[model samples]
Target: MTLSVLVTRATFADIAQRLHDHFDVDDNPDDALWDPDELKRRLQGKQGVMSHGSDRIDAALLDACPTLKAVCNVGVGYNNVDVEACTARGVLVTNTPDVLTETTADFGFALMMATARRIGESERFVRQGDWTKTGIFDMFAGSDVHGATLGILGMGRIGRAIARRGSLGFGMRVIYHNRSRLTAEAEAESGARYVDKSTLLREADHLVLVLPYSASSHHAIGAEELKRMKPTATLTNIARGGIVDDAALASALRAGTIAAAGLDVFEGEPRVHPALLGLSNVVLTPHIGSASIQTRRAMASLTVDNLIAALGAGPQAGQPPTPVNPEVLAARLR
Candidate 1:
């Protein structure tokens, strides 16, 4: 019997075709965002699903889809999926990690630079015809990026990539705070010094958030944290939404708590806070951290590979490369 699979969102043509060739595939080519009930209805009888980061997979949904054996997420962060719930149900969970690390790191660095140097504000000023009335020195004077202190909240693969870019390419001093310290060799490669969270906040000229999102991390940068930051420092978030308090951030920008901010994600995404929309010091972009064409394709391919292997249908059958809960698979074998 052929296993059934569902693609929850539109993807690269080749990826959809590949899944079609291997399974009884049901794809949402229209790329509609399904609510919980609608998603549960669509998932009926499906043995596997290729999921986007926006799709929420939880115990209730898993209960609704008894046939689901695997969930392959196209993004590195699996915050959308309830791993413990999936594991209890013996449903394999996988995410694409390394494929988009460098691409995302590139965007993070770019957003930080844009925020620091007021690139987005200056562009808007030019387009609004305000530039014609102002002289060069008096118009849009912004902060410098070179030789600044670069603080990273997470020192994972992408964080290390950002640190290397700041330290080697831009001559910036790199500091980071993570749950644990990296190896001495890894530290030497990125040229980052591990510091306490408070120090990372106080000393950084430009702070970048690349940490994973979780219960403890939600509102990690709240109003109090904002007050701890230097008045001239710029905050850039290329990490998951809900990691920072958007309302607090807006207030911070208004009060000049920090010089500026660049955000690619939000607390309730696709529905940015009205307050942030009104601020000139804050630069906002819809979540597109790993959005480069080449990297997105790579991520799609990895998700497909994971789904195939998890369902025991493709090359490397029974061994999905990046399982979020490998113990579930081990328990199944036992």
Candidate 2:
């Protein structure tokens, strides 16, 4: 009997064809966003699912999908899929990690550069014909990226990549704080120095957030942290939503507590805080950090591969490439 698969977003023609040959693949490639109830309703009887960031596979969703054997997430972050709930229910969880690491790091740098230099705001000023009235001393004078101090919140693979680009490529000083410090070799390689969170905020001219989202990490940068930052410094978050307190950041931006900010992910996401939208000091993207077409395809393909292997199919057949909750395999094997 063939395994059944449900995909949250339709990726490519070849992808659907490939899965069709192996399983009864129902591709929701139409790209319509489904509400929680609609998602739960469509997930019934599915053995595997190729999900992206939008779907939230929480305890309730896991309980509703008894037949679900595995969940493959396209993006590196699997916080949307509750690993604890999936493991408890004996459902495997996986994410596409290495393929998009470099691409995401690239975007993180881009957001940081844009935020510090006021790229978007300046472009809009030119587009609106405001440049004709202004001299070289125009309002949106931005900061420099080269020789700036870089503070990274998380020092995982993506964070390491960012540190490399900052320290080596841009000649910036790198400082980071994580749950555990990196090896001496890694520290030397990225030229990253470990520092307390407050010190990093105080010193970094450009601070970038690439940490994962969790209850404890929520609002890691709030009013107090923002207050600690230099008035001329810029902040950027390419990490998940809820890492920075939105209201506090908004207040800081309005009050010029920090120079500027770039945000790819926001608290409550898709629906941003109204105050943030009104601020010219901030640049925002719709969580498209890993959105290159080539990278996105790679992510989707890897996610499918993980799901196939975890569910005892595909070329690797029982060999999962990435495992967010490897403990689930123990219960499934029984």
Candidate 3:
């Protein structure tokens, strides 16, 4: 019997075709945003789903969709899916990782550069016909990125990539604080020094947040933490939403608590804080950290690979490449 699958959002035509070849595929061609009930409705009778980061899968959805045996997330982050719930329900969970790491690191650095140099604000100024004077000494003067202290909050793959860029390419001082310090060899490779969280906050001229989001990380940078930062320091967050307190960030920007900020994700995304929208000091981009065409295709292809493998079809019949719950695969063997 052919397994059934659902593609939660529109993807590259070829990705859909690959899934179609292996399973009974149901895809959302219109790219419509479905609510929980609508998603559950569409998920009915599907054995696997190619899910987007925006799609939330929890115990409720798992309980509702009994046939679901695999969930292949299109992004590296799997916080959108409830892995514990899926594991308990015997559903295999997988995410596309490594393929987009370098791409995301590239974007994160771009955002930081744009923020520090006031690229976004200057572009808006030029478009608004405010470029009357040339070479004014302090006109739109911004912070320098090269040779500045680059503070990374989470030294994961992307964080380490950012560190290498800052240290090797830009000659910046790389300081990081993670759950655990990287090994001596890893530290030498990245040229990063591990520091306490408070020191990381206080000393960094440009702080980039690449930490994952969870209850402990929620509002990790709030008003009190904002106060601790140097008045000239810039904060960049390419990490998940809710990692920084958005309202507090806006207030800090208004009060000049920090030099500026660049944010790719937000507390309640798709609906940015109104205050941030009005501020010229803040550079905001819709969550597009891993949005390069080549990277996105790779992510989609990996998602398809996981779904095809988990459903007992495809090249790697019984083994998904990046399983969040390998125990599910083991259980299948038993």
Candidate 4:
């Protein structure tokens, strides 16, 4: 019998064709977002699944799909899946990493610049017929990006890339706060100095968040954290939603707790906070940190490689490239 697999979201046509050639593929070309019950129903009889960031795979879903052996996520972040639950049930979990690092970093830096310079607001001013009446001086004057202090909240691959861009290209001072410090060589390459979280908040002219989301990290930047930041500082988040409290962020923007903010992800996305809609100081975009064509294709290709290997097929069978729970495979061998 042929192995069965499900693609939870619509992907590039070429990637879909490759999946079809390998397994009994069930592709959702319409790209309809399914509720948990609907997703569980569709997953029945499927041995593997290709998932994106929005899909939630937890203990309950795993229990319902007894035959599931592998889950390959197209994005680097796996916060949507319960890796511990999958491991307990001997299910393999894999994610695509490294391929999206540079692209995501580029977007993060761009968002920061847009927020600091009020680029989005200025564009709107021009389109609104207000620019014709105003003089160039004191018109849409905004903060400078060059030679500013750039504080990063997570010094991972994407964070390091952003640091290099700030330090080498823009002559900005880069400081970061990570769960653990990077090696001396790594810091020297990125030109980032490690600092405590409080110092990072107090000193940075522009702050960027690239941390992962978890129960402990939820609302990591809340009312108190926002208050700690300089009144002139600009905040940018290209990381996952729910990492910052949206309600508090909206209030902060309104009160000028910070000069401006740029958010690519939000709490309960596709449904943004109503208060944020009216704020002129915030620049918002749908989650597209890694939306560049080349990077997205590479991510999809890596996911396919992981799925094929995890299902005991392809050239690298039994050696999935990026397993989140390698202990599960080790247990199976024992």
Candidate 5:
């Protein structure tokens, strides 16, 4: 009997075809966003699921679907899935990691430059017909990216990629703070200096957050942290939402605590804070960090690969390419 699979969101036509070749596939061509109850209902007979960040795959949902054996995520971050809960029930979880590194880094750097140079606000000004001859000299003068201090909150793969752009391409001073320090060789490779969180906040002319989201990391940049930043500094978040307190960030931008901000992700997502929407100094974009066509295709293909492997349907049967909980697979083999 063929295994039943569900693609949780709309995906590339080719990707769906690949899954269809191997399994009894149920895909959302219309891309309707299903709430928890609806999601569980759709997941009833599914043995595998391709989950996105918006889907909440918890113990409750896991319990409801006893047939589920694999959860493949399209993005690098897996904070949305309850890995511990999935582990307890012997469900394998996997995410696409390396394929999106450079593309996401590219977007993060672009967002930072746009924020520092007031590109978003200036574009708005031009669109609104507010560009006049009288204010030519100082109308939209903004900060410089080259030779400025670039501070990163997380020095992971994406963070290191951003550091390379800042230090090598732009001649910026790169400093980073992570939960643990990188080795000396890694520091030299990335051109980043190790710094404490306080120094990172105080020194950075452009502070970019690339940290993961979790309970401890919830609102990592709140009111007090914002207070520590230089008034002329610009803040950028290419990381997940809820990493920065959107409310505190809006207040900071309003009071000139920081000169500007560029956010690709938000707290509630798809539904941004009203205060952030009204601000001229903040540049906002939908979460499209790894949005390049090639990269997105790679991510979707990898998800299908993991799902095919986990369900013993394809070339890598019993050996999924990337397993978040490999121990579960290990135990099964034993």
Candidate 6:
């Protein structure tokens, strides 16, 4: 009777099967992303909400949800959820972190290889019946992933995992740029050398962005940065959107400033920039970086756990595995 939950991405049928007995559940299985006003209307009586990457939980939304106790994001990145605002408003915020690290890292590597090797373009060509024994050298011959320089924009857990795959598994020379340098032991383990952003852009055979999005990170890779990259280099982004300037990236792709690009996320996502969509050199995918069936299910389950705990359903019910704004755990719960 004390717990109320609102789930945005997953359906009622899904959670009802699991938590119906413990809490009041309001679910939107249809996955309709409610606009600001509609979301405000929905949050009128809700104490907890489960959200996806697509949902925006910022200052405006926090101003409306007076009863909101917690927001459990189903994705690792909580950039969509403003931690400062939530902490101020006493709303507990948590995300799926370690559970999706390896899965997302694996995906970043996969997308990078796809971009460097022109995999998607080759597939489209073959599917269009363009294949023959001759295999025209210019048809789809692309860059090699092995023995290449792999550069990572952010060297967090997922980034380190990608570095291991590239450096240890593929014989790549890994380089990364982060806000702070990692310990010597970490560098030795991953075999990644820390370099400045410009050096990373110039030297890497392929670059992947895994950085978290924030005010300072918005448009981090714009014309100036993209122009520094090797013309033969490929680029991949599995990070949060807006980190790379979409318009700038599209121009680079169209102009062949970079060999090619693979993207699983975008700026202002779900509403991709039309220019980026029209380019053949760029492989666009619906944001599926953490979308493996198993990982997605785990994310869903973890989100549910956070919501139940947050609304005081049980022990660890109010204590999430990953809390972005831990201070909210002590705020007055009306």
For model 2, residues 222-254, the per-residue Cα lDDT tens digits are 999999999999999999989999999999999
Residue 304 in candidate 6, Cα distance off native in Å = 1.4
C-alpha-based local distance difference test score of model 4:
0.94
lDDT of 6 by residue, 1-334 (tens): 4567777765446644565667677777687888868777787788888887777888888887788878888888988788888888888898988888899998999999888878898889789987767846586778999999999999999999999999899999999999999999999999999999999999999999999998999999998899999999998999988998999999988998888989998987788999987887888989999888788878877877777777677567667777877777766443
- Where model 6 places Cα greater than 4 Å from the true spot, the runs are 11-16, 132-135, 331-334
Native-to-model Cα distance after best TM-score fit, residue 10 in candidate 6, in Å: 2.4
How does each model score on TM-score?
Answer: 0.98, 0.97, 0.99, 0.98, 0.99, 0.95
Better of 4 and 6 by lDDT: 4
Where model 5 places Cα greater than 4 Å from the true spot, the runs are none
Candidate 6's displacement at residue 326, Å, is 1.2
**Where in model 2 is the C-alpha error above 4 Å?**
none
User: What does candidate 1's lDDT look like per residue over 20-70, in tens digits?
Assistant: 878999999898988888889999999999998889999999998999999
**Candidate 3 weakest lDDT stretch, 10 residues:** 14-23
Clashing pairs in 5: none
lDDT by residue (112-218, candidate 5, tens digit) is 99999999998998899987657467778999999999999999999999999999999999999999999999999999999999999999999999999999989
In order of lDDT, best first, we have 5, 3, 4, 1, 2, 6
Distance from true position, residue 309, model 4, in Å? 0.8
Worst 10 residues of 1 by lDDT: 131-140
Could you tell me the TM-score of candidate 6?
Answer: 0.95
Q: Which residue pairs does candidate 4 place in steric collision?
A: none
Residue 250 Cα positional deviation in candidate 3, in Å, after optimal superposition? 0.6
lDDT of 6 at 322: 76
Clashing residue pairs in candidate 2 are 10-29
